[model samples]
Target: MPDSSTHPTISSAFPLNVLIQGEGFPILCLHGHPGSGRSMSVFTNALSLRFKTLAPDLRGYGRSQTVQNFEMPDHLIDLEALLDRHQIDQCLILGWSLGGILALELALRQLKRVSGLILVATAARPWGNHPPVTWQDNLYTGLASVFNRLNPGWRWNIDTFGQRSLYRYLIQQHTPETYQYLAREAMDAYLQTSRQATQALYKALNQGYNRLADLPKIQCPCLVLAGAGDRHITPASSQETADHLPNAEWRCYPNTAHLFPWEMPNQVLKDICDWIERNPEVISFKKPEVRSRGQ
Candidate 1:
């Protein structure tokens, strides 16, 4: 397993905690909303054996400093600064859920710098041509908040029947041990995430954060992995994203949900490794040089 200890550093004037391990071509792993860098341990630990992995706890999540009010642009700036500070000219990105959306944005902004993209259980445009935020969505968010407040650590507390039921429903296709482990880690990260940050991100998503039209702008190789049983971001949505990309492949895992990476770690690892091996050029792709004002 990759070292769980995260080193704190300043990026874009904001304190961020990042987990860096192994040594090879870089792979940046971005976790989903209400999740920290630790949430990506399953993929990071396995990938670290062959490639350097950098998983950062995004702003207002995990050990990173919290911001009262912010938008998606702030996160983009932070990511760019992180890459600059690390002196990484190019790297592959593995993004899950909300992180996948950010990955697309980063790839668009830094066309050459982002060598490849691995989008898991996410969509370029969440809700897929429908209204961004519906009443059901609002109700779901409200209920989640109320549940979090009413039963602290309920998601991971499997001793009680209620907790176990909720855990099983939210996280499917997991063994008893895997369920316990993932639930605990996910709950811990969720507890640390700032509620304000969650709301801000939700608001941003509601404000028409669609990237279907922008998918063609990202010309790098992309692998879209989706879970057939995913309810949050349906497989259809993921397929749409893959279809729009100029160069992309799609794969759907059966009997898996949004947390499929954790449920089927070995398969996901093999798929990613195989894809990277097939696309050797991702490591050697050169970034376009920026000439000074008087070149």
Candidate 2:
């Protein structure tokens, strides 16, 4: 097993905490909303054996410093700074949920720097045409508004039936042991996240963020993984994303929900590894000269 280490990149606004492991072609792992770099360990740990993995706790999530008001572009800037600081000219990106959206945007912004994309349980445009704000959204937002003002670290108790039900919805297929383990970890990451950050992200998504038109512009190889039982981001939505992408391979896992990575870690890992092996071009991708800002 490859050992992992957490390194903090100091920035003027806030420090970005990254978990790095292994030593080979770089693979940047981006976690979903309300998740931390720790949330991506299941994939990072396994991929680390063959590729260098850099999983960062995005600003306002996990160990990273919390910011009061920020937008999605802030994350993009952080990612760009991270790559520049590490001096990584090119790398493959594995993005889960919200991270997947960011990955797409990054690939678009840095076409040459991003060799390929692995999008899991996410969509380029999650809300499609009409974005609905559910009761759950209200609940979290209301609670966050109250709790965040008092204390950002304060978290809602997971023992409640409502929280339990939400967990079940997020993770439908899981063994008793796996359920217990993932539930605890997921809740911790979720609760630890800045409430303001969640609100901002939700607001951004609700504004009808759609990338269907831009998908065709992303020419890099892509592997889009979806969970058939995912209610949060339906498999159909994922399929639509794949359909629009110029070069993409789609795979949907049966009997799994949004948290399929935790439910079926081995299978997900195998699929990713197998895909990489089959697509050797992803490994031998040539790096282009770094362009200066505004080039």
Candidate 3:
């Protein structure tokens, strides 16, 4: 639960449902594809000791209203509305997986509004460098598309057993029970959406999204964090992105995969706060110290 009295907010005009916490240095937290604000809420809550956190469901995911088109620009428009609503001038952005790409784009589009960036499991450009899309990816999406064509209602089904199963496979956590707990939390959070919507978001974000040339154009400092075991977006991608950035640092957690928010919340918060401390331009003043059960 959020400590902020006015949190778990849903904007009437824009309909971007958000969970706001902490009191200083607003940091926007954007969750990955097929994920909702609750996906990152755990990590954001951990950071409440240091920086203020704003975790919002991307358009069409979680409690936010479904968008006609789930494109990168559509997501950005919602983010702009968030900034305007909060009256925040510029703050750091912490993006996880797909959220990393959005944070990079936000910094690229509005450099002044983005003071710093923390990209976890993100890429720079030429997502083509990864091996060709897996057959599993194709099969799941193809089946969903086929089902939706046959029955439009199938596209909006909330039973995300398949999605959660795939996530368990991707997130190589400690135990099956722990993974199940994490997956169930996310499944409950991802209400009112479908696999077709997931495919649409992946397509929109991946299409023509080569930003190698634009990486150098970013004026703010950046930190790229990756998981050694994340096959979806590997460590090499994070390294390539960090290499292209003028002021950036790259780090990878051993034996960890994607979904670091759930797998390694403490480490994630520590690195993020450390990066902000190095920049010193962000709002949080004290060095962030977070403790984890196993860490």
Candidate 4:
């Protein structure tokens, strides 16, 4: 349950939904697709021990309002507002899944506001295309289509089977309200992103300006976290992203899935904390020149 003693506040910058705690330089937590910030609580709670953490439900997820006309750039605008609201000029950013896209975008564009970056199980490539020779894509698409028809205007309760089943047990740990909030926000994210975001993403597929190509442009020291058993995003994909970056380090957690942050929070936090310690200057100071993608 959320701390009722401390009221939840809303921001007008995409009206970001946020959870703040701890002490030290700020660290913004961005969750992946069909995900709310709450999903990464396992990672956030531990990170809070070393740094002030702010986990925001990305635009269109959780309490954040969806933009009527959305675009890739909206993500940056929302993060900008968050930094301004928190009076944080610069901070470390950690993103998982779809949140990793936003993290990369912010690091590339608003480099001045971000210091170090941690990308968990995310690829530099636009993940809009169906995987070649894999029935998984067809299965997921077919299921999504069926769910879309069954639950019109409902975001969370549509498909309670396939993908939902994978995380059901973990979700059971949360309070009823928290679970409901997560469910509703997931539905909203699916609905809001399925059209504009998804189309724009596919359009970018095969283009040279993808996550992989953009890595060398990021001057900040990055920690690329990947799971060995991430079937959706093969281990090779993680290695490829690491290979392109100028100064990126990688750590693989054995026997883990795409949800490594939640599944193995301690290791994830240690990796991030260790990286920040080794590169202390990367945080708590201005290093805009570092992020220029000078190619």
Candidate 5:
């Protein structure tokens, strides 16, 4: 960890509650659903030696500005505003789960701004459509899907999400302490926020378009991470997406589940560091876009 005595939070930048820490190459970190920028602060801090990290609590989550009507576009707007506030034209992106979806969207819209990608525990399509997952994963996902339609915030409860059936399937690698810490952090993110906006944000992820065809157009080097025991996105989903990216390396850690940043911090850092060291081209100040034939 890189000097963690002080808690860093910024409220004046583009109305976004951001955690700006470290001092090195800029790298934007994105957290998953039902999570806030605080959840990924440890991971970002670990990388502080090699990169300056800026993580924003997306609209309606954490201490960030509450959103009344949230959607995918809203997140994109937030990201652009954040980059503009910093006057960052291009930089590396580290997106976990839902954040990966938005990163992909931003990459397509502004390819010039993406120097590289670090996608973790994400899929090319919606969670429901992922393959090679247990029936238990599918069942809970199905129930959550239907419930989200009627009440998008039904899964916001810590008790409900911590149920043995659902909790066991999401993260298999944990201890009494780690589990408790993660559970509390997860609940705290939604403790104070707009339920309507958060629900809409959760629902919007499922409506994303197919991006498999666009993967090859990414010009920068990429690293796709997966957990062999990931029950949510599934290892197969990550593998499939990695296969499409023209310049990418796929690494799936054994016995790990979702939330690799917390479960396997050292391993995550090592792999990311190694990838960055090997691919200096990804860190170039200006990486040209790769125009597909049709475009």
Candidate 6:
């Protein structure tokens, strides 16, 4: 909502809307489910102090036009197209929740383009090991109900105010009408991509795209950050992801939930910036040579 319209728009396989802030090496940040690139603007604001940040609303979410047959492959292709538009040959990727999974997939498929990877509160088998049935059910039901009402032909106009106004109206404090409007906007997009999204979810669930098995294929330094109290993904899941990546540093925040970035922005920012600073040469960042007994 911060006037994202001020950013550039590019034509790819789909119409792509992106926000680029600051000027330095690129650090692309991806947001979680049912959310847009604007959701991770907190990170962009922080990282923009040092690095150029590219945040795009994934396909089927926010300002990005929905891809009719949405899937992991579609997302990867969209990302590739976006990069091609920008003429960015290589960059770092930071993804949260669902976005993290996509980031990993992109890194796996295009190793040379990715310099480093950062995953937060993301798991390989997210649907298979969800937090609770009730929560998941509630989310899907709410989304489905909302999607049913939108006109499939309506297109979202990319703008900065849309992000700010909507976030304030929904995420901050919302009345019934506010919820209704947000639901309407969301559902309109959802109805268009529901079938493909559902199919992709089913395949991802059944195939078990194990981040663990795919870890060894990653050629960049990786950082895994998890919230200790995240029911959706336990510390053990983070451990499993870290174990898979040969060059991964893992950390768990003791008093955090699944929403670490929202709850403890400054702390998360420090950790990420510190890691990036230390790893000036991508995977070249080294852990301390000595180990502490307390650690």
Model 6 per-residue lDDT tens digits across residues 1-295? 0111122233435655788898878888887665676667768988888788899877776677554765556677778788888888788999987788888888877777788999988865453234334554455445434332442211231122222232321222223333344454444434443445556655765676665666687868888998776766566787788888888999888766565666566888999888888888762323435877997
Tens digit per residue, CA lDDT, model 5, 1-295: 0111222233322367889888767888888777788877756878776677888888777777554555556676678779988888888888988778767766766677888989989866645432465777657655543443444334453234333345555556644434444554555664655685567656665455467877777877889998888877878888888898888899999877776666667778889989999998666676457899999
Q: List candidate 6 segments past 4 Å from native.
A: 1-12, 125-199, 283-295
> After superposing candidate 4, which stretches have Cα over 4 Å from the reference?
1-13, 126-209, 287-295
Q: What is the clash count for each candidate, in the order shown?
A: 0, 0, 0, 5, 0, 6
Model 3 segments beyond 4 Å from truth? 1-13, 126-169, 176-181, 190-196, 284-295
- At residue 60, give the lDDT of candidate 4: 62
Sort every candidate by TM-score, greatest first. 1, 2, 5, 3, 6, 4
| Per-model CA lDDT versus the true structure | 0.77, 0.77, 0.69, 0.65, 0.70, 0.66
- Tell me the lDDT of model 2 at 136: 76
* Residue 280 miss distance in model 3 (angstroms): 1.3
- Residue-wise C-alpha lDDT for candidate 1, range 228-294, written one tens digit per residue: 8777788899999999999998999988777888778889889988888888776665757789998
Better of 2 and 5 by lDDT: 2
Give every collision pair in model 4.
124-211, 124-212, 155-187, 217-293, 219-290
The superposed Cα distance between candidate 2 and the true structure at residue 192, in angstroms, equals: 1.4
The positional error of residue 207 in candidate 2, measured at the CA in angstroms, is 1.1
Query: Against the hidden reference, what TM-scores do the models get?
Result: 0.81, 0.81, 0.74, 0.69, 0.77, 0.70
State which candidate, 1 or 5, has the greater TM-score: 1
For residues 85-169, write the lDDT of model 3, one tens digit per residue: 8988788898987788888877877777788888988886524233455777666644533443344323142133324234433
- Per-residue CA lDDT of model 2 for 43-81, tens digit only, reads 888889988999999988988857578766678778888
Instruction: Flag clash pairs in model 6.
Output: 1-160, 1-163, 1-164, 3-160, 4-160, 147-187
Model 5 pairs whose backbones collide: none
> Candidate 1, after superposition: displacement of residue 146 in Å?
16
Prediction 4 TM-score vs. true: 0.69
Candidates ranked, most accurate by lDDT first: 2, 1, 5, 3, 6, 4
